[model samples]
Target chain A: MSQVPPEADLATQDLPSDERAMLERLRAGDAAAFEQLVRDHGGRMLSVTRRFLGSEEDAQDAVQEAFLSAFKALDRFEGQSRLGTWLHRIAVNAALMKLRTRKSRPAEHSGDELLPKFLDDGHQATPASEWRDGGLAALEKAETKELVRRSIDALPESYRIVLLLRDIEERDTDETAKLLGMTSNAVKTRLHRARQALRALLDPHLRGGL
Target chain B: MLSCRELVEFLMDYCDGELPPEQREYFEKHLACCPPCVAYMKTYQQAICLGKSACKDEEQKPPKMPEELVRAIMAARQAK
Candidate 1:
């Protein structure tokens, strides 16, 4: 019944002693270790928060909150989880906390409109376009990456967060459902639709290449 | 074999490996014969990949970790 995603644990054993070293120092309340932890992990944590919060200021605040919380909880830390993984989980929670407090924006366009329409006869109403062949490798271009980011931002917050947590953050389905107070089935549906809607948003830009 | 629409309904569950054996067989069988559906699934999978990579720090913004944050947290760490 362990719902922790496998990716959440990462590979602590393979990581050189630098992480273990840091963990020990920080657990001892060594100030420099704490600072170094923030410095090393802060960029990634901020990126995680920004994906959820959108606003730069809120993202930074959330990262800071997560780090401070992690610092306070140090003695409870076991060696089983990677320092990065534990910090990543704390950062996700911090971002979600920020998300909970912020006033939600006005609802965007209908997600239903973004899904592929099927005919009454149970066939796709439209033909699939030929996407550039490299799959996501096509997104390696900086310009395309920006487009992907903009397309995600265009999604309504409700579905977008589900996509972020389940696919990007790689939380298990049950965990995501619990986080959003929905059932696992509901999480799966929303995650699918969120991916669909995001695909719709990207379709226009991809013209020949999503 | 499942129809295209039936397969569409199964797509998420299929990808999640949630489809039970008989249904899973039928789902794969449908994809086996249906090239359009095959293309659709590939694009869908790619979109997920795109979504996952969209927000990495390397993709957006400078690498600068905040200095103010470091100072604030360090001060708090020392105060404890």
Candidate 2:
């Protein structure tokens, strides 16, 4: 599947020498350099924030906040990774914090509450022989794409976040682990479980054809 | 010898090319001898293909960077 290459490359390539020099100038109170930095990273930041927050207003606010936060912390910029990755980290944090606040408000589970019951019994333990019976059939149907999308979106936030970062965003496992504060092994384990859950969700549709 | 269940557990890692080389070799041997495992692999490969096709639409469309919004952001930064 063709994906829009991550916007993170913008700062990775475009800035560097210029950005570091500009940042040095900003340290000396160069407001114009700071403005250039903002113009360079702002839209990409907004896009990443929007993917996580799912609201245009929230995304815009998050991007602004991320820039403000980045500016205040500019002295601490370690340059361990690309500026885009650094800024994206801030954007992701802001978006997640926003999501957490939204989750704090009482909300219905939307039937997702019942899924753990099925999962708890090790329904995931079903043998491959049994899985073969119908799993392929479900996948072949035209609506399978929509089903897969909804299934992914339905995953618990923790699993969904890891899957998106590790799989969809194509972040390296170690990078994802660092981003999530997890060990690489833990990331792999969660990713494996997440894929299993997705497979289970698709099974009913695929089973008939198998 | 890995049980069918154990093989199934490793199948996803296999598909992702995440399996360690030694373990991958072990699974390849198992696949060579096990018809069920081969079929299982086929099913998984198909699932991945379908999933990729499905997810492409979600990921490919570049997010719209509205001219007004970009202008507003640029303007705000300029005024800062």
Best by TM-score: 1
For candidate 1, the TM-score is 0.83
lDDT tens digits, residues A65-156, model 1? 88878876766666457777778788888888888887776766767888888888777888666476645666878788888878887787
Worst 10 residues of 2 chain A by lDDT: A1-10
Per-residue lDDT for A148-182 in model 2, tens only?
76777666666667766766667799977876778
Residue-by-residue lDDT tens digits, candidate 2, B1-80: 65555676777688878789999888888788777567656755554455555555544443555556555655565666
Model 2 residue A110 CA deviation (Å) reads: 14
Q: In model 1, which runs have C-alpha deviations exceeding 4 angstroms?
A: A1-16, B1-3, B21-34, B54-62, B75-80
Under CAPRI classification, how is model 1 graded?
A: medium
Enumerate residue pairs that collide in model 2.
Answer: A134-A206, A134-A207, A134-A208, A135-A206, A135-A207, A136-A206, A137-A206, A137-A209, A138-A205, A138-A206
Given candidate 2, what's the lDDT at residue A108?
29
Instruction: Provide chain B's TM-score, model 1.
Output: 0.70
